[model samples]
Target: MTKSDTITWIRLSAVRLPLPVPVSDAKVLTGRQRPMTEVALLFADIATAEGHRGIGLTYSKRAGGPGQFAHARELAPALLGEDPSDIGRIWTKLVWAGASVGRSGLATQAVAAYDIALWDLKARRAGLPLAKLLGAHRDSVRCYNTSGGFLHAPVGELVENASAAVARGIGGVKIKVGHPDPREDLRRLTAVRERLGDGVPLMVDANQQWDRPTARRMGRALEEFGLVWIEEPLDAYDAAGHAELAAALDTPVATGEMLASVAEHRELMRLGAADVLQPDAPRIGGITPFLQLAALADLDHLQLAPHFAMEIHLHLAAAYPAEPWVEHFDWLEPLFEERLSIEDGRMLVPGRPGLGITLSEQAHAWTTEVFEAGVAP
Candidate 1:
């Protein structure tokens, strides 16, 4: 690649969007009716001298927008004049540069923005879609709907949501559990199971609401429902507890969404903490480390189901040798110009160069702040 392909300028911005419907899980059961909002996104756009630009983003539930933007600003100088395709070198450099502060949380989230943009840039430069660029194992992957089944909704509403998702061709559905009364959780699960029947896959997320004993007791009780997996039955860092719960229950234990590094995931695997691994690209330092973690999961023969951001995870999931599940979330749909295509529970991977989507006019309008660095072309 020519010098024109080198990074010339970097732009960072924060976008705050109000959720059309506030979502509450078991962890936030008290705030059920309140209309919660999310900062939604912190975006990065890397412009190369060749004039091609790649866009990337990380998200926050309701905060961390300012911190992510500030970290990106601090990291941008290290990337200016560097080759956009040198993703590994750049990722390492950024990680070490911010090591004094920490390698996880906001810092890694910031690194994700740049690293994702670089992969997008590289894929676009090659004129291949990200999945194809990464050597896709398949062009489409199965999906499950998780947006509708929140703890705040009535039991009838939960059943309706899962039914509607199945009618729309989604193969699976998940609902929030972890109420103070385990019987209440069981009641909701029973209703959903009756509605969806035995054919449709059902899963539940506890959202780390239990200790080891509770997790073990509840996991065994819920086994009768034939759940696809029990997600976050305990705190994400509780490796020994997770392993114990996994061994004691018939249901597969799944976690890793909140984790921040490959080393953390390595520890989880080493401890046999989970039967299924759910890594998020942005949270684990973007696509580079995600690939590393996926490889590790493959060697261990664990199931792969990445956390959120289906638009990005769809491509990564398709790269997995075994069939993987991508989560369907419409929360960020307003920020993008194109919507993903789904049929019969599988989403089609975009074949266009890079991630194959552009930020919408609404995304620009929602921008709360912007930061820029590097020389103009």
Candidate 2:
């Protein structure tokens, strides 16, 4: 006999995790954004009437953290008495509940937390890791370190960071490019490549700062390095521009991390805009929608390299059909009690059930606000 579990309670917390130092990329260098000093995280904890619990999270950089928290607070009650196993159904309902906000961007991001929580709940109930529950293709995924490659670091520091990450068992290193001075960008990459040698899986991210002409020139110039990919060479929305850029360069063009909806990613694919699709699980409305998008990307035979939040992406990447890359940023390590394993250039899928994570005392200490829904003592 089967007993349907009803989601009876939901708790949302807003956290501000401070970075050890200000972070900068081409977005900062180009004067489009300020250096980042902290990240705003929104966490969802869902409890079922049967005493089953699950956790999920989403985050924002520089701004919009509070907005996501607020949205989730308003959206939490909708889950009360609903089947926790009906992830796709609940996701659709949440999207329509905030229909005024449209189906993408902030709305999707907020709903993402709950949607992920449901999947986590489902996996925990089945006593399996999320990747295995999702039918993983591998037990581990290739990894690359991006935190040490921000634009603010000097060339010496960049080389040092790359060297350290490689030695630490990361499969590759991705440095920030798209400097105001193209020559300076070239100079930095030359030094990094010279130090890392040709065998390493090296990559560069423009962070959407390059125009077509600049991207074209840099793409041509970058050919000698044999990079695994060039990320966000143009604005993320410029599918046609990215398609042209992807065609012009032998190196695969990667983008879509900034996109907020399946439609946005579909447009990128319809035009063949990118060779590598870098969707973020939390950013695109959690693993529910991410799996939807992954199916589409796989159909195109495109490469996958989910952006940040390695904790969540490692499981998702492992489940991907094509070998995928998971970006590593240890900034969120303090939030969780469990740590991921990296060995021989890959991140192993944790065998623990669900997300295989529990919030740390530090997470509770950093929590700025809390909201509870449909649960009363």
**Winner by TM-score:** 2
Please give the range of 10 consecutive residues that has the lowest summed lDDT in model 1: 30-39
Per-residue lDDT of 272 in model 1: 93
User: What's each prediction's clash count?
Assistant: 1, 0
> Which residue ranges in model 1 land beyond 4 Å of their true spot?
1-4, 30-36
Candidate 1 lDDT over residue span 1-377, tens digit each: 53445888999988998776666787776433343556568888999888878888887776677888888888899998887878999999999999998998889989999989888888898999899999999999988888888887889999998999899888799999998788899999999998888988888999888888888889889988888999999989998999988888889999999899999999999999999999999998899999999999999999999998987898899999989999887787888998888888898998788998899999999998988998654
TM accuracy, model 2: 0.98
Give Cα distance to truth, residue 346, candidate 2, Å: 0.4
Q: RMSD in Å for candidate 1, one decimal?
A: 1.8
**Superposition TM-score, candidate 1 onto the true structure:** 0.96
Top model number, lDDT = 2
